[model samples]
Target: MIKDRFSDDDDGLQPLAYNMSHDEGNAANTETLHLNVLEDVHIFTTQFELTHKLNVIQKAALLLQSDTSLDDAPGLSVHEITALANETTHKWQQPWTMYLTIVVTALGAIGQGWAQTSMNGANLYFPDAFGIGSGSARDNFTVGLINSGIYLSNGLLGAWLVAPLNNAFGRRGAVFAAALVSLLSNIGGALTQNWQQLLFFRLILGCALGVISSTLNIFAAECAPAVIRGGLAVSWQMFCAFGIFVGFIANVAVYDFGSNAWRLQLAAPFLSTIPLLILIYVCPESPAWYIKNNDHYDRAFLSLCRLRNTEIQAARELYQAYLQQSTKHDSKDKLTYFKTLTELFTIPRVRRATVAAHTVMISQQLCGINTTAFYSSTIFLDANFSKYSALLASVAFGFINFVGAFPAVWTMDTLGRRSLLLLTLPLMALTMLAIGLSFSIPADSPAHFGLLAAMIYLFCAEYSPGLGPVPAAYSAEVFPLSHREIGTSSAVAVTSLWASALSLTFPTLLNTLGSQGSFTLYAALNVVAFVLVFLLVPETRMKTLDELDEVFAVPTRSFIKYQLTVYIPWWMKRYVLRRDKVELPPVEGWRTEEYQAVCQNEE
Candidate 1:
């Protein structure tokens, strides 16, 4: 009699469990397939679940929140359930990692800026401090060459090295490597005599720096809980702001040194050592990497607890759950370097996500954000401000950028991805139009209208929160969890290339097209981007990867849902109906009311 009762219960969960099962041939025991069906139902039925986030993590998080102890947790294996739940549901605060990582990244970027800034700013202090030999052509060539090196290293090599470096050295290792290379490069830049030598070393330094830029983002995501990921990731912009803050002070203090001012400016970036040490001592390796190494579960658990400042056994349960999810996402599949390379190309979602990441990156750079950032000092100089005031304004740009980034970060989980990205183009384009128009006026135009210059600066501030961070966030997300590392490296690589192009060309482009023409062209491209955002992109905010996968994996053609069959693109279809496969009889009227009874009977 009991055997017959259990059989009826099995019929209840068969529909949603279909894809979850390993084989279509196994029509048998479909009830056991989903493993999470009952779990998910229990969760969504609760009030705590975010209406926005209705996926496995949300379910697990809700489940753990209700359960008091690991032994009492309503699941087998407390370790696994707890880790996954805490990241999605229980939000814990830890500044050790978040603050340190941001500071370290910020300091590292300053070192990179020193390589370019004062020397370029030479046009101000010692007009002949470093003379440009010829007329416009020679001056343009020198600036163009310096820009080229920055682009090639970051664009071409940075992308290629990001994955291997991270995999081989771990995130910490990569950052350490960047610091060491930066130390050497800053020293070399300070000591160099010729333009060609300085350019070569700067490019080398840029390549090394590029590696750090590409990987730090992925590191931030893997370490942070989903709730705080955006907040933590935006720390880079803060650090970047601080770097500018420090650089401005350093530039002004040493301007009296004439040519020597450039050397002090060059070496100043390595001063980020204080934060770098904190990161090295306290920051934990990603728990995801521990699972990747197989059987290091205990160490992995401790790392999470330490990072989150949680109790050990309590952290263990959560770490285990996280391990399982991470496992599902980052399958070992013989994690060979070569295998990593080929899988990125062979996987469809991986390829698509990579393309999206790359496109977002190219657009951010080509849209003229970096050039605007790079040349702001020049623009201020052109406005007839004293060099120190221009330096002050450059530092101010960092603060505005930092402040601007907070809105995007706060809204990322609240607002949809498509909406954030779509909204960017219109606002960004208008700002650029103002910038170009400001430059269109005669040289004698009063500094009072410099509000337009402020708008150009505002455009950059706007870009980071919107388009600036989008590419990195997208790279960390877009692919199926299984190939995320490889997929992201590839996506970032393309962007690195785009960064290189921007660095190399922008100086020349600015000179050739002039500010009015340059920004006008980019503004026109923003219109096309606005259209693409509406036509192709889907909302990603407040949703899980699995939800995104379900949403995007479908064909963007006709979709038929029961009577309310609203027309949606094939890609937007949330559920798949296997027409060739069998369908279970409806849960009848009891599908809703009978859930508790049916599940209770199964137990």
Candidate 2:
């Protein structure tokens, strides 16, 4: 009878046969067999079941919350409790294998960064070589289109492939496949003889990059402990910044290579892929992926052990992940790719995550970071700097971009995701405005060139720590594990689409609007991005993947209303009005009667 009940369980919970020698009762049987006991007692068993779920949920919550004692946790040894405590107190005290996984996967991001900026110096030399150097409207549009080819493929094809690739190959396998494609595409791009050939290769590169960008962040987030997941997952952005810096260096190095310098720049990013292919094998598959895709508890436990500090810690996490998976209520086999995509918008919790993900991903582009990343050298050359001077200034921009991202390794998990966005978006806007205004200075004056380069550098500094890292990390974490791939892919697709649009039109805009109007337009768009982030995005830092469900469950209107009626007022009183002892009201979750009894207070 108990076996029948377990088989019929909607939550996919296992039977009590795999029992632990703990005092709090077998976690599985407590949920499963307790109902059978109550059936003969003429009791309100449905109410009891609801109360039991709440209790189990609360226990799971404590496992992820810092400063909360785990005295109530079953089967934890003294060493295990100490390990969990250390996770909060010393967030850096992690297993070396976890760090190894972060490094290998992050190399994929570096490859992406290198691929992006490889064309910056090439941009100066290639257009003329390809007969598009006449500076006509048609030529400019063609340059933009060639530059944006990768993003076009990324949006239309690569992003959509993420779900299938991940489903078929898992996170590591998808990365492997993408890396191989990137390697082949880079080689093909370097050897291309014509504009059409170059464009075709770039489109192939974009598809691979789309898969890598969407998968690697999710892998890092899944492998990492909740306490440090933000820091680790943003490794993608940090390494990509480093890669950008190196690509600039490569461009400078190969400038004297004469006619073939552009080809070498195209070839340089492929080197990053070689190391990625070798090192990725050393990293274990994401335990969360294992738990989500199959009933391989032992495999999940083993992966967790490699990633965590202690066996007990791994066991605890493995069980918690299992419980979280059960709550998805549908089997993995039932969730087709299209159904998952549909749920991204239809399910209330998932829809909220989708909104947050799309907001950050789209805003990352609109804030105008890519304007500097893709075309800083062009923009600097336009400001009357010589070719070598423009290259040097771009190199400087790349360095500042890399250095700026270093702080996010600490601040992302500490200041929180939403706080970083709110703090940096205004600065990005102002710097962009300053860049736009710098173009008004007479081109003959050194200050014209100086101010343009300076403002672009400042904008990079502002971007690296916030929008650059937050988008991927935030998108990776916001969705439930069940919908993570499809949801993040959708968000990544939005990013790719915006990036394609920006890349395809920026050169034309520069010609038409001039540098002044283009920078100013992006600055204004940054303000729009800030408003959207403030109104719609929820804070996701320091929360486990499961815990984020509650965070995103709060509707957009509720979140926005709280920001206006509660949080904004408190901030004004406390910070602006110089008031003391003003208390802040907590943001509430969706309060349907069923959830009202079980909802834990949001911190």
Candidate 3:
């Protein structure tokens, strides 16, 4: 392989054969006492201590099997690690890889997109024929429930299904399943004879979309090597933005043509699959998933090259990491569903990151993305927009959200997390208040102008640049690798709870209090959330996941303080920082030969 490379780069690193299973295993174990370059890589014979010895692959496998924390590792700076990671990861979003992700994403989006439109007919316009009239207080409540049902259901079912299925079917299979669910469920909703039937399809659609949303993110992450993960994952989020946009467009189109528009609307998302399905036939699955689990090294390596757009030799670092993860699957206890969550919380850094991530996500919903997405059409109609004009206004919300993701993708590595959140939260709160205030004129008053339309577009569009992508990104990144699945799931779960509660109840609340009261409450929540984010959330951009463990291994007043304490104060982050230096996490204490059997018991 290139005649023992690194010849030009004088870094004193050496490669060793990565095998542990052998007849001389006992002899190797006795010699497993590793040497350390003490305080700063100096050879320290005195500090050497006896510890459980693991082979190179075993140590590397710990990279994947460990929690999401990347706060510490040997021989690399935190910024260097994060930069390398972001560059490699975001590559999955390139035209080729992204097309696959988008196609798979459509399978999930179909159900969600259709659900968004199911209530527009009854919600937007009262019947103009015969005795049909404007909806009273009760009709608004009924229509609102129909609108918000999907967001609520996605969060509830996502945690329960996506992880389990992803673990079972590989990322591609899970996403494919979601798309199939969408195709059937959307058609079902379109044909439903009554609201109950529509609601049932809506909930099913939510579950399907949740499955897709959760898995596709991990899918995008895995399919990507290391360079382009952020941009690609954000693209997946951007697709969701447009999914809502497509929902708005369906409402406008149907309103323009048909009288009973809801039927036509429910079928809109199914049409998105035409191009998406074609891509899936050709898109490669996650190489890490394939290599680690299926033991198909040749295919996984080829896919990795395509994913990274580089030669296989250049991808040695990632390949080695995959090897490390595989060793864990062979040697460690199987990660059961319940214990998975237990480890997520019990670990110090993971728990901290989970709280931080969940806070940002919960705040995003509290910022009113759902109310704006689900109710903007109704609001425009109430504000005196023409039949199809309101739908156009609603579509504008989705457009802003879609475009809003760009700046975040560009700046995520450069500007860091806390700076963006601090920058966005206050403005989001203020803009939301402004939208509420513009509609305060009494219905009979001359001041009842059409500023509501302008206010909403401004509110939805501007808030998106900062808050739209930030919460989603923070929610995913702030967790350690080990607990990433469970920790992020918990955060998403909390956000979903609020999203569902708001979606299910907002219409009734709006009718009872009037638009002024409803909007005002949303604005107030934004203010409270803004305060919480500023005081609590840490700057995580450009920091390795393990280094974050060093920074936040313990509680602190703020993220900066955590960083300071972890590094500067007393080697306080010792446990997370020096994982190789510490005792290994408690696995089943058994002879090496019994390793696979212990995992079998858990499985």
Q: Flag the better candidate by lDDT, 1 or 3.
A: 3
Can you write out model 2's per-residue Cα lDDT over 63-161, one digit (the tens) per residue?
444432477543344565688778889878888899988888779988999999998878988888788878889999899988888888999999999
**Each candidate's lDDT (Cα)?**
0.58, 0.80, 0.59
**Tens digit of per-residue lDDT, candidate 3, span 296-412:** 555565566565533322234444654456445433247677877787666556666766787788788888877777777777667676657777777776677667767777777
lDDT of 1 by residue, 356-459 (tens): 55567666666776666666676677666677777777767656765676676676666645567777788898888777777766757674347665886678
Best by lDDT: 2
Q: Count the backbone clashes (under 3 Å) in each candidate.
A: 23, 0, 38
Every model's TM-score? 0.73, 0.85, 0.73
Q: Worst 10-residue stretch by lDDT in candidate 2?
A: 1-10
Ranked by lDDT from best down, the candidates are 2, 3, 1
RMSD to true structure for each model, in Å: 12.5, 7.9, 11.9
Q: Is candidate 1 or candidate 2 better by TM-score?
A: 2
Give the C-alpha miss distance for residue 322 in model 2, angstroms.
Answer: 2.2
Model 2: per-residue Cα lDDT at residue 72: 51
Error of 3 at 579 (Å): 40
